[model samples]
Target: MVYRQEIMLTGAGGQGLILASIILADAAVQDDKNVVQTQSYGPEARGGESMAGVILDIDPIYYPRITSPTVLLSMNQQSFNKYIKRAGENCLVIVDSTFVEDVGNQPAYSYPITARTRLELEKEIVANIVALSIVNTMADLVSRQALQESVLKYTPEGSSDLNLQALELGRQLTHSYD
Candidate 1:
């Protein structure tokens, strides 16, 4: 049986974690992979923490909740520290190094994901899309065409080009590791 792949996204609210997860999940669907997504957040929308978990399988995806993710993207220290240990052994951990100084163990890759977006996209929220691009590339999780299509269709209206840059930036970050 073809193995399943799982990915998790975490960060404070307004970082675009939920938006990025939707694109990734949609891309998996386009590839005919079974997909499940779950998210959690605190009381308010702007300042609290948030997270998204996505599970993809070649066969049926029974549960929507992730038991153990194979890939993790964390933009804050709190979410990173909490879930870092729960991820699988071979999992790839991607973090925004500018804000997170303490990511414990398990093979991590750090990038100024949020900071770069603030400069390039002129907005802090677009960082999640940029980070998602890197996650997709590093994991070989989704095709660029699939990503492009989803970004175009799903991004908040009038924010297309900015989102595109986020995806490209994410793609660029993966090269540093290779």
Candidate 2:
């Protein structure tokens, strides 16, 4: 597999973009690869725009920021518009269809990520984990075992099961092709 892949995840503060990025970065670390994780969050972390960038490669990563991303995931409408413009032809863009009514003209995979996490999974904070699960499945950049292990490693003492469930649920969402 190609090792150098830049992932740009953007969303509202409460949407879990940073958490998802951290999960992806840690998974890369576990794979014995070079990885860099960074974030851009607004003043209102709860409601404001938030983004996390993860770059992983066989070679050491020098800069933390993404120059060009291979994947772009945006939750809120604002973030979708902001980052959609940055996407190239081959980029995979994931949007939370719950809040992002308009996908613009970018290359994307529009999904009701938040809605599925809330209504289907019956969880709130678990949405980010759910979203990351879809990303991992779609890209194949991060292995399934690596991501699951990352969740097991860093999840809070009691929430490991929920996180794993969320990941499984999210993975299921992608296969249905909805």
On a 0 to 100 scale, what is the lDDT of residue 6 in model 2? 91
lDDT by candidate, in order shown = 0.84, 0.86
RMSD of each: 1.5, 1.6
- Number of backbone clashes in candidate 1: 1
Please give, for residues 1-178, the per-residue lDDT of candidate 2 as tens digits.
6667999999888877887898899999888889999999878849888989999889878988998888988888998888877788888888878888987566578788888888876877898888899888988878899999998787788998899899998889898785
Please give, for residues 5-39, the per-residue lDDT of candidate 1 as tens digits: 88999988888888889999999888888888889
> What TM-score would every model get versus the actual structure?
0.93, 0.94
- Native-to-model Cα distance after best TM-score fit, residue 139 in candidate 2, in Å: 0.6
Index of the highest-lDDT prediction: 2
